[model samples]
Target: MKDTSTGASSGEAVREGPDTFKRTALLALGALGIVYGDIGTSPLYALRECFTGPHGIAPTPQNVLGVLSLIFWTLLIIVSVKYLIFVMRADNRGEGGILALMALAMQRQRGQSTPVARPVLITLGIFGAALLYGDGLITPAITVLSAVEGLSVATPVFEPFIVPITLAILTVLFVVQRHGTARIGSLFGPVMCVWFFTLAALGVKELVHNPAVLSALSPVHGVMLLVHNGWHGFLVLGGVFLVVTGCEALYADMGHFGWKPIRWAWFSVVLPSLMLNYLGQGALLLRDASAARNPFYLLAPSWMLYPLVALSAVAGVIASQALISGAFSLTRQAMQLGYSPRMEVVHTSAEEMGQIYLPGINWALMVGVFTLVVTFRSSSALASAYGIAVSTTMVITSIMAYVVARERWGVSRALAIPVAGLFLTVELSLFSANAMKLADGGWFPLLLAVVIFTLMTTWKRGRAILAAKLRASSIPLKELLGSFGDHPPLRVSGTAIFMTGNAEGTPPALLHNLKHNKVLHEQVVLLTILSEDVPHVPGAERVVVEPLEQGFVRVVATYGFMENPSIPDVLKRCREKGLQFQLMGTSFFLGRETLIPTKRPGMAVWREALFSWMSRNARSATAYFRIPPNRVVELGSQVEL
Candidate 1:
């Protein structure tokens, strides 16, 4: 059975039915709202940047055909073949992306025994996760700057205000995110869908004007460019990286939409239109490369120009919105998987699944984007920072896919290695090419990622160090239970469930409870929530209870990284299992610790203070976990680092 709430399978089997089909189509369209928003809008700026930017260098006639050919084949190989035909099939129990694929592959390797436990697999997964953060930060800045600069294209009078105007626009966009995209998403798919078709229509008219542009489709042109132009051809790889910017979203949002709907949207809708539009732009540019300064808008007729500008602007906003939302989802996934600090997540709709907002991710991106807009005012300036992050991500994804192909799907050795090698070669070239831009504004995102990565690594290590310190000299639970003997119970009556982060390990607050009260509550439930990357689990797989005499009951609630566990709802299910519990006085105990600064080798004291400050102001567990305020108890602890 498949679940409607989260749209994930209820069993280990990857199940999809009539209803799943319907919602997946709807949400995939929703995901399409997000997925195609960035790359779909890329046609707006890609050609302009390719010609006007320093490396693009005015695009000579000899290179123009080859450039067009590279764009064509790049999209064909990366998006058409790799993503649509191949990578999407590697979904894990209807879930997708590098992490989901890794989880599935790891699980399969250890099936009926133990799962794979290789360090390289885990590290590759982390690298993919890291690249996403870098990509997310750059997407908003570049997208918004590209659109806002269209003002200058309309009238040079708007140039002076571009930065301030762009910053203000982005600030407003980030501010409005809490209201949820679900309500506004109705416009997203239709606008982007229309945007592509309209561009396609325009492209068709232009291509009909000059049929020679279609010859650029051959790879020979791209290869010839490499032979003739020397390594300068590699510079276009950075721009080509922009062409498939939203490809990751295709796989990441797969859980919301099944492979079929996405594939349908990609081929029948997105692909044809994008190709026609790119070819049309190429044709237009072939006539006058200077027109490449604005191929997308130039393709439009004079009468339709303003409307095209307006539509393009709206689509640009939507494109950024989709990537912004994707960042939120990925952050939540990261937190659930133990790599990020706990952040507040708000559910956007009652019926719709995976509609969420993370305050921390929301603000971080807003600030980062605004700063980028101020620093690098043009799309081309910000473009240097764009493709490196995404290409690195794609390369990491290809590596993860290789592991999955062999270990999980039982794919043949002959097929898997070569296919992986082909993508790796292509992606490696693109990544290296983009990497060459680090001297330009490319350091912006990389610097941001390194800061984030440091925080993530520090938090992880600090946690491990604390855990090891606590574990090394801690009293055994079995011995302690025997000694304590549930000592003089009678605190709260029925099922006072305490949510603990540590499951098999000793929970710090539990010791505090033992030391202070010296008495246990009746039917004490020590609950721990576990989140896995592969979305959703069956009800039968939900509860893992080990009942102890004298009022102790340990409960574990498992959730998908994409899903949030509602405590009240989980408790209701427990009640249905005949573990009757009262809601009003059930009392949810939560732990809140303040990290004190330490002279750790990882980060400077200022960064440590920033993390501590962030921890202090973070949303409380009562609000975050959706616990009733009056019924919640928070225990605070001081940390050395």
Candidate 2:
């Protein structure tokens, strides 16, 4: 089956998007709106961070030239070469990113015996996903703080309000997310396009002064920065790498825009301009030291700084939009995979697969990000909170990529080991640099990630344990039929389907059917829907049937967290199997088992009350599955957990 797992599978859908080159070009440009927002807006504060950050280096010509050169080449090697050119190519039928890539590797790794060399790929994927929680908190805080702090550039009078203004901007950003990005999405590409051109213009202007600054393309300069300054220079890598912070977004967003557009945008516009801007900053600094405060802002006319800041704040909002939407998508995908508990998902668009909403995830991120903004409250503070998560995630992606290459594609020893080893070098370096920031507000994001990772792990474990316990106690229908073989089957009026937790079980309604009505329908249907991590199973895998003597056994499916299986459609699949199709009076069987308080206790009273509360308001299977209201039956049983 084709996997919607990662960047490695993006080929199918992206190629399928448009056959004509012109149409494809338009689609690619259109995609730049949301896809490239993160990297595109780095001009807002990229150069400023390098100069003003904690460091001993003077903002003199040599230092300025050196720092800007480092920024330029880093963007080239890290973003352009690593992700845009190389990683984005690994799409799974137009799906892209670390998760999709790992999903592809996992399908190929199924049932393989563990070996010393081949650790599990899912573990790597989980590690990467865990790191993203850190990325999420810092992304919003840094993006907003950087923009709001620019007000100080307009006038120092705005300095006192920076914190409040930053908080207000973030609150507004999260609050309006319910509206979805469809309306503003059109504006994304144009704004980013303009932003890129502005960066290039700045770079080109500086290049005219001292074109030799471009010679920093030599790798030795990067080595020099690390060697001479030693630990302090390593600290700058923490800030320097911020220029490439949006690289992960390129992969995460591939599912929505397709790899074709993202690849085109990066190569044609995003990469070149970023390099130019960095070089220009370096060249300008080479000419004059005082201009080092912000070669980016200095690239523009003094009159334009406020307008530039305003434009940047708007663009930063769009950048935050990409991550916000991405978190929703990842949560939905995780839920679909049975890694998370049931969450309420709302589809935001008829035509766009990328537009999705999960109220639980949205609110949680809103709270986390807002808390971060209030606590850190400055672009510099939030910067300390950002880089480590993004860096480690890149490392994890590399590990997962190695798994895919070795196992799925069957790449030989020489190729796989070297590629994985190469990534380990760069990733370890970036990770180590970012690691030094852990105590300086970085713990906030780490703490957030730990909390989220714990919740996710607990949900997966709890559900698995509960399902296993039910399955162990379940009575198979064949054995059940044999037990009651002496008696003839009873007759009932309507068809009934049990929404069961386990694939095989004596649903409480079966006992109720025997006790109350004493008869079965002309056609009895025992149905159970299975959840899988994969999204959108093809029709062939949609249903499985096993017929017993009295009725037909039907197993229909949907997804773990995102999708609700349509009862009518499943019934249609059942009929297509030549059994029968009946919807009007078909009764859905549900077990409304109540948790009874007992002296032989397991949980605290508060916990018991919480569980009971959850049960009371928890969405019913009928509504969750879109089953009709009237034709439903619930069989209550007394139970304790």
Question: Which number leads on TM-score?
Answer: 1
> Tens digits of per-residue lDDT for model 2 on 205-299?
77888889877777777677777778777777777878888888877766555667767878888878888888887777777777756557677
How high is the CA lDDT of each candidate model?
0.73, 0.69
lDDT of 2 at 445: 62
Clashes of 1: 2
- The TM-score obtained by model 1 is 0.90
lDDT of 1 by residue, 461-520 (tens): 555655564565456666666765556444556557778766765466667776777656
TM-score of each predicted structure versus truth? 0.90, 0.89
TM-score attained by model 2: 0.89
